[model samples]
Structures are given as structure tokens and as C-alpha cells.
Target: MSNSTPQKFEFQTEIKQLLDIVIHSLYTEKEIFVRELVSNASDALEKLRHTQLTEKEVFDDNLTLEINVTTDDKAKTITIQDFGVGMTREELVENLGTIAHSGSKAFLQALGESGAKNSNLIGQFGVGFYSAFMVAKSVKVYTHSWRKDAPGHMWSSDGSGTYEIEEAEGQRRGAKIVIELKDDCADFAQDWKIKEILERYSAFVSFPINLNGKRINTVQALWLRNKNEVKDEEYTEFYKFQAHAFDEPRLRLHFSADAPLAINALLFVPKENTEKLGFSRLEPSVSLYCRKVLIDAKPKDILPEWLRFLKGVVDSEDLPLNISRETMQDKSLLEKLNKVITKRFLKFLEEEAKNRAEGYTEFYKEFGVFLKEGAALDFTHKDQLVKLLRFESSLTEKGKTTSLADYVSRMGADQKEIFYLVGPNRASIESGPYLEGFKARNLEVLFCYETVDEYVMNNVREFDGKKLTAADHADVKLADLPKPEGALKDEDVTTLTKWLKDTLGERVSEVKPSDRLVDSPVIALNADKFMSPHMRRIMKAMNKDAETPLRVNLEINPRHAVIKRLFETHTAQPEKAKLVAEQLLDNALISAGLLDDATAMVARLNKLLESV
Candidate 1:
């Protein structure tokens, strides 16, 4: 039943070079060889399954369609057996020793053209089998073709140019590759090592995978299944398994697309934002998979950095990857995958906001910072992200939030801008002088509390064709409200403003009678068009040079009692009035979060009290 003589053959010229690259320099991680071998087994099994539908009288037809892996630490040998379609002697020689029809020629040509920079172009040419030599001192493939008449054969190679093939007795229907591990790679023969590799890259493969009689890939690839058939509990289980978290997901998006790269993505937002809880910055967790085999576990470029909080998998069958399957060969296709997934996720958020308002609000409370970051930095999705931003406004009750679309809906027909004020919280913004003018005019101003809000608003710039203007900015021009009785005369208001400007000198860029102040004596707006007072304070906190000379466009409410009295006191008591003017500027600076020193204000306050 066995042939005593073995037929020996030299490897094709290109295959010799390929073996050198694959064995010596191709893969960054040696463990990738496990994934490649298992993926090849899966492909073989899949082919047999398709063939079974059309053909009859197959060899080892009674054998179950699965992959079996065995590791022997003492012997330093690892064996992977697939009970699927096997190979004939001629087929083995053609597949393993030659490059004529295996596409290895084109692969080598591409490698030569791209040089070492593109050395990762391995898997494109169906040479995944060569990866075995990376860890093996010698490799043996015992196979029997599925055809009833085909005989069993064993192909052996030490990966030094030539390989030997001989007839072997009692072989199974599928290929069984036995790798005699090199001394340095003996760890590959450990059961735990191979098990870990199986669970990571091949866990979601269609067929069952067994290691030492225990099933490894028990969890199914739910993303590939119909959404209607997948239950909530099943999704939850899969999420916990994939994300390695105990807490349930807050939101899940399970979707697939045919066009734009045949994508099947399952993304989850965990119940808690770990980064919000003061944990270390999150890395991208959405793994990239091609045909159920993981390409990258934490692919940095799969999604925009702002979306790092998301956890799940994005599998595309259309990826054009190189040999190691380590790096994607086509960058534009990867970008397309990013765009498609991002837009779909954004659309899901919009639907959730529309149909489940309360739930979306809770999610926004925990994860809104990420959206703000995206809105500020990701220009491609800025418009959609801006619409999803929610904030409390003068018109909404405290704790209630309004979307930009809702805010735009409530805007007066003549209102030209969306006004917002940044402060530490709602109370601080409401108490600030800037809100009074908008409140009196019945113009709603959004309350922005987070540190990133200003940056988001500044970058988003506009929504619904209305500019996003900071309420306290110097350039803001609000609709004038009716002047109440007992206010200072127009002439006196002008005189007081001119006198204050002359008294304050360089400290005041320009003092003017306020159209935007209703009840407060004064409000200070940063005169520097480039930097807001809030931004200046942030710069100072970061220890950057924010000490550009303090100059503010001070606006005084003519109706306030202090301003009316100051108009009278300036002419009668010039020294006292000058002290009052300086104190007011400092008060405004403190309120604007721009005051660097309060020593002068304290002295001025003591003098004013003594006079009183």
C-alpha cells in the first residue's frame, strides 16, 4: 500500500524567494502562521462543502466537516487536520513546489517591483502554506483527495529548496499538516498557545474548530447572520464575549451593506464610558476582519480616532490584502470602509434620537464628549455630528436639552445667529451678565458647560445656515430690546463711556453703552478676535503663553443704578469715579475667567468702602 521510493522536486525559482521571505522576513508576529494555516483549512473545507452538493461517492464522506488541531509539547510537533477536500500527488507538487498556476509568479513580480517596503504582499498569491516553514524545522502534509479513486500521498519539505513526495497508506480524505517545530519555536507545540491563537483570529470562522478534542470557536459570527434571527440575549452574549466586559452594552448597531465593499459590521457602545470615568485613553477596539479571519485586532485606521470608544468588529470580504494579511494593500478601500461604517453609525444615532429621545439623552450624558470631539475635529461628518449635539438653552427647563434642529426651529424668523455662552455650569451661565440681554429680548442662548464645547462650536461654526456665535464675544450684535424708563439719557451714556475709556487707557479697548446688557452694570468681551476669554484661560491652564495684554470691549448697562451713579460721580468726584471704573473692569474680568491678579481690585475695593 506504500511506495518505498520517494519522488523529489526542486521548488520553483520564485517560490524559493517566497519561502525565504515568508520564513525569514515576512510576518511581524510568528503566531500569524496559525491563522493562515487555519484559514487555508477553512477554505478547503468550504470548497468540499460546495462540491458535496454537486458530486457523489466522495472519499471519507462519513467524516465530519471540521478542523482538528493537536499539539505535543514533549515531541515539539503540531498537527492541523481538516476533514475536507484533500490533494493528489500532482496537485501537491503544483500547489507546493511550482509557481506557474498558483499566482506566485505575479506575487513575486509585485514584490520585486515594490521592494522590501511591500514585502507583506504574501496572501494575495495563495502561498499561505509557505508560512508553515516560519516555525517548522520540517513539515509533512499527508493528504488523500476527495475523489473515490485517488490514492493517499505525503509531501515532505525541510524548506531548503527541494521537497519529497511519497505514497502513504491509511490517509484521511483531507490534508493533515504536521509541523516539526524549530527549537526557537517550540512554544507553538503547546496546547495553550495554539488555543489562544484559534480563539483570537479564527473564533468566528463558519466551520467548527477543535483543539485537543475541545471546541475553540463556540461563538458564532452574529454579524453575518440575519438581524431578525439574532435575539437580544444572543447579541448581549456575543458583545460580552467580543468586548470582554461584564456590563451590558448601552447601544448596538448591527448592519450590513452590499455596495461600497460588502461590509458586515456589529458595533457596540458600552454602558459606561471608561474614559469618562477617568480611565486611560481608549485605543481603537473595533477589530478588522476579512472573511471572518481577523486582519488587525485594534486597527488604528479602521475608524477615526474620535470613535475609539466604540467596541466591536468590522468585516469586509472585499479587502485586498497582501500575504501576511497584516496590512491592507489598498488604502482607498480602507477609507471607504471607514466612511461607510461612520455614516451608518451616525444615521443609527439620528434614528435613536428621533424614536427614543430619553434613551438618547442618557447616552449623550455619558458619551457626548466623544461626539463633541468628532464635531470639532472630523470635518467629513461635522454636519451630521452638529445636528446630534444637545444643549440646555434659555428656553428649556433646567436639566432638559435641545438639539440644534430644535433650537433652529424655535429661532425667530429674523434671528441671524445661534447664540451660546460657555461657563462651568448652567447656574454660572444663567447668573453671568451675558445671558441677561438675550433673556430680555426673548432670544434663547445655549448653555455650554463642558470644556470642549467652545472648541466644538467654534469649529462647527454654523448649523441650519445660522452662524454659531458666542453670546459674550465682542462682535455679537443682538436685536435691541425696548429701553425701560429711568435709564441714563443717551447723551450722558455717551459721555460716561468716553470718560471711562480715557480713564482706563490701554486696559479698555473701547468702552460703549450696552445694547446687550439688561440688568448688569458691565460685561467684558475679549477684544482679540482670534482668542475668546475662555480659550485664553484654557491656554493659561496648560501653561502656555496666554498673557497677551488684557484688553476687553467693556459694555455698560445705562439702566443699572451703578452706571447711572457713575455718570454723575465721574464729573463730581474724578478720583472716586476712576477707582470705581477700575474695580468694574476687574469684576468683569473675574466673571469672564480672564483675571490673572486680584490684588489691585482688593485695594480699590477697600478704598471705595472707606469713602462709603
Candidate 2:
């Protein structure tokens, strides 16, 4: 591009293919064109910033390095202009009109030689300039190089196939991009609409972005900035903007890592879990960025699915994006990123739990379900996630929480298994006979109340070398203890056990003396030991026609006072004893969630009361 004449050239084969992808399928959202152009502008400003540092004879270094955007609905055009490192006529032709040789390569080479690994370079691939065609019918680039003698040029392109270059007379340093909007994308020429897209996507760009001569992107890239320089109010405002959340963030993690990969990230946990409130499940909100430019505003692969509750930004220069797939390669490196960030967050939780118990408790009450989900499903960080889980247990007061570590610390020397009982609540489990033996032995048991607790427990399986077991399982053999005074004798126990097995028949898998019962007269255990409390509830809820009637092992504490009384009464009044046996069995069936026949139990109780 020279002042003497103008030359038009055809695109290269690779440029044509790249243009097809960029215009058709490279970006999922058309609004991304704005982000790409703004990013390119920021890169130009950054290049000027570096050029001033090394070169003494810099031209127009006084111009403020900012991106100014202007939109006009009447004209159906939008203009994004920067004031740093404008290109010369030949430079414009090479950088915009064609992709033969871009200063971007030289810019990258110069910055890389400076030993500044993260020197932000824009237009590395030369495809960002053409993205304007996604929403524009034609585009014009006006620029003057840092060299004072070099002439400014205007490169115009419809981006259909070819572009033309000509010299321009009056131009400041840096570049000005004017977009002639397409008919379908005419709305972008409106100030309000373009401002909205700028605020949503490029709000945190380092450079000042002004739309219609007014500043729009005012927020700085907090992720890349020093944490000590940031304020709580700033973090809160950022969280609100990034997450589209009105409430303050419950927790936040600001971190930077130079090893493994050069990474800088600021993550937030919202004050509430919308999904818990019966809202629609949240899509991933944490965005991915390189330097200050957003690459993916809703990246699905940056974090695990269970971490959708977290919101913020993750920016890394080391992340090599597969331009074709828009996904990252080197999964192991991604895992490393996942591990480093997750570990830092988990460590933050441990600190919060220790130093700020009340606040952490509130956060746990709202967002704890997600941690449990990760612990149960994400094996990569399961161990770390498990430490963050908290639950109410038999040993804890109401609303108090105990972690697996705390439970393990309190376990008796002889106890080799961690005990947990799944039920509606503490009262339900207490009312049932499951807690009797643990209570007698002064052992603690975790109370799982949520429906997903079963799945969590199964996936976890074990923690700290102790196997997790259900307190009410049939196979759980309690330690032998001395018999109580009012218990049935040897002969009476044998006869009663025989009579119970015969009377209950198929309903009773095996009637025997109870090892788990200390006060309760009888306890029923599932004959199909595989069916846990959670499993039974699932089966009952899913398939109404399931023919598998629950078979339970009926066990009676021979030494209990109720057993002694029942033994004497059976011989004295066989009819009353039969009714009592049926009532006891019904109680166990109800506890196991298998009792469909409540009508008989009521009638039997009425008959017994009348006789009394």
C-alpha cells in the first residue's frame, strides 16, 4: 500500500479455507466477532506498550492506549478504533488485505526474545481480522505505522473472496476498524446493543473500551491483577457481573501458578445454589481466557460438571487451544490444572471451616450438596472432596456437623468399620431399633438424610482405611455382652424362636437370638443383605409392581424384659401372644419400608386393648 498507486490481490488457498471456517462454523455465537475485534485492538495497544519500552524513537507514544468503539444505527455501521502501533500502508496490506507476512510474527519473536513469556500478542493466527465479516458486509482498516515517514493506508474487504488496498492521507498511530453491518446484523450498529455485548464479554479487558464515545468496559482483569491490591467490594462486584448473580459470593479463590502451567484464576462460589431452590440446573459459568481476552465465556471442559456452582474466570497463556475443535489438547495438563485449582479451593475450605466455622457452616448448608456430588462422582479429586463433606451424626447435636475424619478420630480401638444409617432423620433412626446396639456400646453413627447420600456412600466405599457400613445391615454382628436379668431362659428361648419361625414362615428368613438388641425386644434384618436402606427406598419408588417381597431375619433379644413377658404370656395365652407376634413383625416391616398391610396391625392393637 503506497501513495503512488493501489494493488488488489487474491487470497491464498489456506486463507480461503480458514475464511470459510471462520465465517461458517468457527464460532458458536455471532456476537463473538465483537470480542475477537476488541481483543485484536487490545493486542495492538499492548504491542505499542512494549515498543515504547525498547525503542527510543517511538512515534505517537503519547496517544492513550485504549479501544474506542462507535456505533450508528442510521448509518448501519460500527467502528472499533485503537490508539497504539498503527500499521503503515504496506503493513496494512500484509496484515489485513493478505496473510503473507504479519508483524504479529515479528511481534511474537521480539517479545519472546525479551524473556517475558507472557508478553501478550494479538492476531497471532491472522484470522481475527476477517472475523468482522461474520456480522459485517464490508470492513475498512485505517492505520499509520510507528515510523514517522511511513504512509497510512486503508484496506477494504467484503470478506467474500478478495480485498483491495489503497493509501490513506490523514491517520493517527494504531488502527481503526470500521464495519459496514450486514442486513441481518443491523442491530449491532445500535449503541445500546453493542454496549450490552461489550459489557457481557469484554468487560474485564485491560484496555478502556468506549462505545459511542462513552466508556463501557470499565472493569479490570481482576484475575491477572495482584490479590492484595483488590478490595472485597471489587470482588463482590466482579462476582455479580461474572456469575449474573445479585447476591454476594459465599467464597472466593484467587490464585496464580507459574509452574505446571502459567495460570492466573479467580473463582467464586455464589451465596446460593439456584438448583437447590428448584431452579433450572446451571450451565458452566466460569469463563476461560488468555491474557485479558475471553476465549470461552462458558467453557464446559475447564472444570468438572459438579463445579457448576462456582463462577469466575481462568486465564492461562499455557493453554494451547486446538483452533479446529475449540478444545484443549494434553488432557494430563488439563488434569494438572484441575488438581492445582481444586486443591487450592479445598484447602481454602479447610481453613474456613477451622477459622470461620459459622460462615462456612452457612455456606455448607447451601452449597454442600455439590461438594458431596464431587466426592461421590469425581474420582480425580475424591479424597480431597471427601474432607469437605459434613453431616449430622448420632454423636453430634442437632444442626451440628461431623466430618469423616472427626468420626474416625472418635472411633473405638476395636472398631474397624465406620457406621452410618440412612433414614429420614435422627428421630426416625432412633425410633427404629437400628441405634440400640451402637448406643449400648457408646459408638457413634452418621445419620444420612438426603436421598443422594446412599449413592455418595456407595461410591466412596471407604475412607481412611475403614470400610463404611450400615448400622442396620443383617450381617453386622455385634460384640457379645452379658445377658440381662429379665431375659427368657434357654428352654423358653428355643421354643419361642421355633414358634416365631413357624408362625411367620416365609416372611422370616431366620429367627434367632439378637446380638444387636440391648433394650429393644426384637429387630428385623434384611435377608437380602444387598438391599440397603437407600436401595429399598429407590426400589419402592421406581417400580410399584416389584414382586420381591422384603425378607427379614427376625431376631429377638432373649434377655430383654419384653421378651421375658412375651415368653410367659405365650404359654398362658397363646391367642394374645399370636397377635403380639404379628404386631412386632409389622413394626419391623414398617421400619424396612416394606409394610403394605397396616390394616391388620391396627385391628390387632384394637383387639388387644379390648381384651385388656
Candidate 3:
């Protein structure tokens, strides 16, 4: 090939095909073009740094190792510069124009049978370098080799058909790439935007990354440092920077594992949940890293969906990266890594719960939903995450909460069930008749306020050898205490229950003395196996045309004044007794959240008010 002014080179057939795929579909986010280019520049600088250590007479030894980013808004062009190993005219043609120079083909060719068998890479197609054409109309790379006599050269390509190579004059000993962004992608031409993309993807690059002469990646990758060498403030700063949060982390787990898979991780629970404030569902925020190089930000498979709230970085050394590091192949290995790290983080939580009770409580208030989700959805860690849960219980003071372990610790030997009640607040639960028998037995029951809590307990089923029982369930049995003085006589009470059942007829499943009554007169119990009060509410709310039928256990406390009087007044005045019984049942139904027809209850209550 003879060149008069400059030589234009056609890409190898394979590379041309690879370039088309890269420019069209290799990346999901167009901004990745910037990161890919910056990473290449950083790699060149890193190689030059290693070369300077052993080489006595290095070319352009005086040049500093730094990355300079300049954005030209007027020209809609962005430039990335690094003082690293560059290339000469022929080197530029061989390096930038072909895929063989990347060391990928030979590495794959020489890949040992066992090494190739290990499925731990993300990219292998050798087209990641061509991703720049996704958002750039044209790219110009100017580079000078490290050799003293090597002349600087410029490589220009429109990324359409061909690229040109020519000798450039007075170029520094590094690589400078200029990208002319396409019209729609002009946002990269702003200095602030480039700085953000650099900080997110290349913040841990071994060398300094400067934007418009100001240092951008100042924070060191603390995960790579020795645990003792990192100060607490540095960790906090990293957490704030990575989490995009202002408050100190309520909990932090930082550790390293080497056997199963070499992994270093730093995780944090924020001070508050913005989602709890009625914000949208949170997306996964943990970043996956291989040797401090970001692989994927917000990777879905790295952690379970239940861990979406946790924020931090996980740097793994055993991660066999594909060329681009965009995805991973060895899922079983990734699962192993996930298991090890998740277990360790949970163990850290356990330690925090024991050693830092107050701190854990604060964190629980914010991130407990995540644990609840884990308990309900992640069967692999359900038992462990269940133990990590905390809730306010009858045993704990108001505003204080008790964990499942604590509740189990306080459980009586006779109590085989871990009882919980879903309600709007503490007052409503305490005043409800279902709790009377439980309270009389001095049994502690967890109080759940959110709709998801019931769904969680229902899914979890049991924890630590005790069955998780809903305190409001009609089937839950409480020990019957001795009848109070002035209570209805046994024979009369029996006759009255029989007649009330007969009178209420189809509306009543069973009219009987509740085994769990103390202060309240009567309570309605739902006997439907499939539909809980909560499930009923949810289903009814969702379907406007569907009707929810009422089927409940009408329970009577023999000792309560209202029930005692109703028993006596029933045979003496059958008509008024009917009204009084209906009214009493309505009042009980209101408390139990079973009687949907509140119009009738309201009418009866008003009538009774007039009689009074």
C-alpha cells in the first residue's frame, strides 16, 4: 500500500462485522461509549506507569500520568486525553484498525482447556472497542509511541465504512480521542455530564481522572485497601458518595472472603426509606465490581430483589471477566458468591443487633421492609432473615419493638404459637375482644401495622419452632378462665346460646362462649379458611363488582354485663331481646371488622341511644 498524502485502511472483515454489531446493539445505554473510551485511555496510562518502573530511558518521561477531559459544547465534541503509551503511524494502523492487536485473540487461542471451560466472563466478542460509534458521528485518535524516535500519528474514522491514518506533528507521548457526538447525544458535550459518567464508571481507575483540569475521581476504592488502613470517616464518605445519601448509614458491613470466591464488599442501610414516604418502589443500587473495575451498576442478579434497598459496592477478584465486563456467565459461581456475602452481611446484622442494639433498632425502622420481603419471598434465607426481623409486641413498651428471637425467648413453655395481630394502631388491637383471652393468658403477640406484614407472616408460616398464628383467627384457642360472679348461670347460658343460634340462623356460623373472653361481651370470628379480613378487604377493593359474604363465629363472654342482661332479658321479652341481641351482635361485628353493612349497625346504635 503506497500513500501519497495519507493512507486510509479498511477494517478486517470480522472486525467490520463486529463494529456494526457494536455500533447498533452492544450497549443499552449510549453513555457507555464514553466509559469504554475512558477505560481504554486509563489502561494505556496504567501500562505506561508499569513500563516507567523498569525502563531506564523511557520516551517522554517528563509527561505526567493524568486523564484530561474537555467538552466543547459549541462544536458538540468531547475529548479524552491521557499521557500513556501511544502509537506511531504503522502502530496506529495495526492497533486501531484491527482486532488482533488487543491481545484477545491470542489469549483465547492459548486459553487452557480448563481456563476456557470456566464460565466467568461477561464479554468475549472483541467488539467493545467499537461501541464509540453508537453516539459519535466521527472519532479522531492521536497517539505517540513510548519509543524515543517514534513519530506521533493520527487515526480518523467516520465509523461508516473506513478510517484514515497519517503522521501527526508534535504530539505528546499519550493518546487523545476526540468524539463528535451525534445531534441527539449532544448532552455529553457538557463538562458536568462527562464528569458524572467518569465518576460513576471510572472513579477507581488507578490514575487520576481530571475534567477541565479539576480532579474528578478523588475518593479511593476503599474496598481494595486493608481493613485496618481505612479510617471510619473514609468509609462514611464512601457510603455517602456511593449511596447518594446525606445521613450516616444506620448499619455498615464491610468484609472480604477468599475461599469460595475472592470477594470484598461494603454495604449500608440508610437512615430512612424514601419509599416509606409513599415514593415509588426502590431499584437495586449495589454495583458489581471485578478488581475495583465496575462491571454493572444496579445489577439484577448480583443480589436478590429483596435487597434492593442495600447500597454499596462488591469487588470480586475471582470474577473471570469477559472482555467488556457487561455480564457474567458462571451463574452457579455468582450464586455462591451471593450466598456467602448475603450470609456474612446477615451475620453482621446479628452482631449489630447484639452489640449495638440502639443502632440496629434505628436501622430496623428504616430497612425492616427488606427483611420482611426476604422472609416472605427468599426461601433460601427465610429462616435467617426471619430472625433478623423486629416488631412491636404486647411484651414491649409503646414505641419499642421486639424481634422474633426476643419474642421466642420470652415465650412460655406452654405457648407453641407465635401470635401476631394486624391492626391500624395499638389502641384498636388492645380494645378488640380477640386480644382479651390472649392478654388474660399473659401471652405476648406481635403487632403488625402494614398490609404486607400479614402477607409476610402468612408466607413465613413459622419461625424458631413456634407456629406464627394470627391472633385474630377464629381457630386460635385461648385457655378459658373461671366465670366471674354475677355471670349467667351455666344452664341459662346454655339455653340462651342455643336460642341465639336458632334466632340468628343462617347469619351465624356458631353462637358459643368464647374461650378467649375477659372484658368484652362478644366478638365475631372469621371462620373462612381462604379469605382473611385483610385478604377480604384487598379483594373487595380491587373488584368493584364482586361481593364479600359475611361468615363469622359469634362469641359471647358470659360474665360481661351486656351479655348477662341480654340472657335474662331474652326469655322475659322476646321481641326487645331480639333487637338487643341483633344490636349486640352488630357492635361485636363492628369491632371485628366483619360487618360490612354498617348502615344497619348505625341504625340500631341510634335506636338504642334514643331508648337510653
Candidate 4:
């Protein structure tokens, strides 16, 4: 069958160095050689697929475009054969015998400089075929080019320094790689091991991959297909297979982008947050891919940290991956990918919030905490994240919520700031004195029940040009309400406030008549502009020094009966007025969550009771 005597050729010096690097230090996983060989076969098949379109006649036209992997545990040999485009003797020497590509040469220089720790540099140099040197004591590649006129050839190498090529008889139309597994890497010769590797790395390959004639890649890479043609059941199936989740995804975003970098992404928001369900914090689940081959299963940098709840695949043909395709080389491109995918998902949420209010509200109920985290931490998307924020407000029914944009739309022209009150529940915030003034003036105050809401508000600072002002802060200035009839004279109000401030002394920052209080007898506001009550609580819980005691301004409603009586009692019974003033201050402090030690307040309350 030999057309001429077998010819032995020394590997190009760079190929020798590359072979040494690959065999000694380049790859961490020896089994990855299977992946490399399979990928090489796939590339050959893909090339032939393109070739068939342009050429009129093709050799072995009836041969199916599929990969067949046969493992022989007994012989300790694994053979992967693809019935696609094969190489001629000259092509094999050119492709396999030398580092013909400049990229591969540069890769070798990088590997040499880095001491061959860069396993991620494998596929970049067109040296994916040489990875078999990692596990193979000897590798034989029998290939017949896809042209009938091109004769069959066999290239053999021990991967030390030289290889041999000779005419081969009765060959097929594509390449078949036979790896004689090394004694230490005999596991790859097992059927189950190869099947698992194929399932992990090549499950979504465009061609059928058969393990001993049984098809393994049963699922398609649905993200690559036109989404309209993919059915709902198909997408659900793909999600289940890709995410390994039993429950269905609550939402899905299937989109493709052409600008900046070509991206095809299919992201899914699960039915429940596993972390919220008492599971550990979720890791990034979005897999990264290039041309249907997986790059990284859990790409840490492809999406922002808050998007860890998302599960899906992001594929970009434009990504410049290092040789092994394990790590992405272009950081800016990855950031662009992150931005594009995140921005698209945000736009999708915005659309859902506007067009499907109830669905978005339900989603917000489950996943809004993540959005709050992004709004507080991710400045680039803060504006979009703020719009997606939802909260119960003074005007909404107990369970109902509204967005900042919606709140702004309902804002009175005279209103210059957005108001929000942080508390445990709707009833608590409404029952408290803070909301009484806002309610009286018909100013809607957003109700924040979760702890992160205040943090989000502080960082967001403003939305649509309206300052996000906490209702309890002393700096908040509500429009003055009309003074009702029977209100105390200005002189009398001034006298009562001065007497109360003097009695309270250091305990109160300022005691004054409130222009905002209506039905409430007294309202409290935090005087420290820098620290809100919630922030103080957070600091205390964290054991961080507050550095200053909480100080608050007490505002009295002169129209209320308590104040009217206090004004008279202060002149008649100064001691009793003192007890009442201390009691009022304690009550206000309790409402504001600033009361650290309440023993004195209890003693004061008993004394006031004796007077009553």
C-alpha cells in the first residue's frame, strides 16, 4: 500500500519546543487531549461543511458528518474519527509538522517566557492537534483529503522530536486519530470516562458525536438558532439540561447582538433564588462559549456580581480566547460583553415593568433585593436599576408598590424632593408620626421595609433631578400647611418651645413649632445630616464606632391638646411639665429607633403616671 518508503522528518525546532511544553507543562488535565482531538475533528468537519457549499463534487459525499469516538480499555487506546474533511500528506506536514502560523510562534514565545503555565494558550496557535502529545505515547492520524484525486496518507509521531508519513490504503474521507494512551492516563481508554468528557465539553456541538456508535449530543445549542423557530418546550428542555435545575425558569431573555462584539445570549431567571431559599450564595452560572464550544462553564467576569442569579449561555464569535480557550484574552471585550448582556437584560426588565406590570411586580417581590444591590454598588447601571426599583408608598394600598418614575409622575409641581421612610412594615410607617405630615399635605412617601432600601436610597441620592430625601432627616423641608383656627398665638408657641428646649437641654438638639405636623402631636427628625437612624443601627450591629451620640430635633404641634396643656402646665407645674417633656422626647426617640437605653424612660413614665 506504500506509494514510497516512509519518510521521517524532524519537527520544526519550535514544534519540538511546543511539544515539550505540551507534554511537560502546558495542560493541567491530561484527558483534555480528547477534547483537543475532538475539537480538531470538529474543525475539519466544519471546514468540509463550508467546502461542500462552494465545490460541485465532493469525495465520500455519502459519508455522514459525525464524530465517532471508540475507546478500548483492553488495549489502552482511544480512537476518535470524524468522517469529514481529511488532510493530504503535504497538508499534514504543513499543518502538523511545523508551527506555520505566526500566532503559534508568538504563543510559543509567550509560553517559553511564562514557563509553560499558560495552558489557556493551547488553541490559539492552531496546535490543538498537538495536544495529543500530553497523554499519547504515540499518535497515528490516518487521513484522506475530501478530494477523490488526493490519495490517503498516515502521519505517525511519538511526539518526542520526529514524525513519519507514508501512503495509506483504503482510507475514508476524513481524519481518524488513534491515541495509544500512556500508562498513567489509561483512564481515557475507558468508555464511561470518554462519554462524560464528551457530555461536558461537546454536548452542544453542531455535529453528532457518537461514543462507540451511540449518539451523545442529543441537545442543540438553542442560543445559536433563530429564537422564533425554537419552541417553548425546547427552550425549557435546554434550560433544564444547561442549568441542571428541576424547576422551570421564571423568565428568559433570548437575544443576539452585532455591535461592539457579536454575542448570542440566552439568560434565565430561575423560579426561586437559591440563596433566599437558605442555600449558599449563588455563583455565576452563565457559561461562555465560542463557536458552540464551551470556553468557561462559570465565567466570573462576563456578568456583574449581582447577576449571579442568572443561568444561561453567552456565545461570542468575536471573543479572542487564549490558546486553550479556557481564559478570555481581551478584558475590554469581556467587559463589553458584560455590558451588552447586562444592558439588554435591564432593558428587558424595563420593558416588563412598563408593559407587564403584574408579572414584573411578582418578579420584584422575589428578586428585587439583587436589583437594590446593583443600584447601590454598580454605578454604571444605577439609573436603569433605579427605574426598576419598586416600593409601597403612602398613596398605594397596603401590598401595592410603585416605581420612582411612577412616583415622580404623581409628584406635585411644588414638590422638589422624593421622600421615603424606612420601617418594618406598611402599618408601622403609616402609624408613625413621620408619615402624618406627608399624608396631611398629600405628599407621597415611599415605604421601605427591607434594610438595604435605605442604603440604596443613600447611594442613589437622586432620581430624575429630585433628591432622595429621607422623611425622618432634619434637613427634609416639607411645605407648610395652613394654620388651623384655635392654633396657639405665635408668642405662646414660641414661649412653649423655648421652655421645652431649655428643660430638655443636651438631650434635644432643637425644640420648635412644626410647620409640617397636622394630626400628630409631636414628630422627631434626626439632626445629624450625615447619619440616618438606620445607618446608626447598621454601624452598631457591625460593632463600628458611631463616634457621636444620636441627636434629633423635636417638633411640636401647637394645635394639639397635649401641647396646649403643656403650655399651661409649664407655667403652673414646672416639675410635672418636666416629666411630660422627658416622656415626649423618649416617645419620639423610640419611634425613630434611636432609644439605646429605655430604663430612664420607664422611670420617667411611672413618675408622669403618679402626677396623672
Please report the candidate that would top lDDT against the real structure: 1
Instruction: Please give, for residues 480-546, the per-residue lDDT of candidate 2 as tens digits.
Output: 7776676667888899999888877887889998878876778888767567646876887798777
Clashing pairs in 1: 121-323, 122-323, 123-323
Q: Which whole-number lDDT from 0 to 100 does residue 466 have in model 2?
A: 96
Clash count, one per candidate: 3, 2, 2, 6
Per-candidate TM equals 0.68, 0.67, 0.69, 0.67
Model 1 backbone overlap count: 3
lDDT value, residue 369 of candidate 1: 96
How many Å off is the CA of 43 in candidate 1? 19
Best by TM-score: 3
RMSD of 4: 12.7
Choose 3 or 4, whichever is better by lDDT: 4
Higher TM-score: candidate 1 or 3? Answer: 3
Error of 3 at 28 (Å): 32
Stretches of candidate 3 above 4 Å error?
A: 1-67, 70-207, 211-219, 323-327
| Root-mean-square deviation of candidate 1 | 12.5
> lDDT: which is higher, 2 or 4?
4
How accurate locally, in lDDT, is each candidate? 0.85, 0.77, 0.77, 0.84
Worst 10 contiguous positions by lDDT, candidate 2 = 115-124
lDDT of 1 by residue, 1-612 (tens): 576588899998988988887888877778867877887898788667655755767888999989999999999999999988999988998888998556677666666655655444354356778889999999999999999898899999999999999999999999999999999999999999999888766765668899999989864778889999989987786675466454689999999999878999999998987666444467788978777766666788879998998989999998743312345567788889999999999999999999999999999999999999999999999989998999999999999999999999998889999999999998888888988888888898999999899988989999989999999888888776777899999999889999999999988899998888877899998788778988888878897655656668999988899998998899999999999999999989888988898888888899999998
Candidate 3 structure lDDT: 0.77
**TM-score, candidate number 4:** 0.67
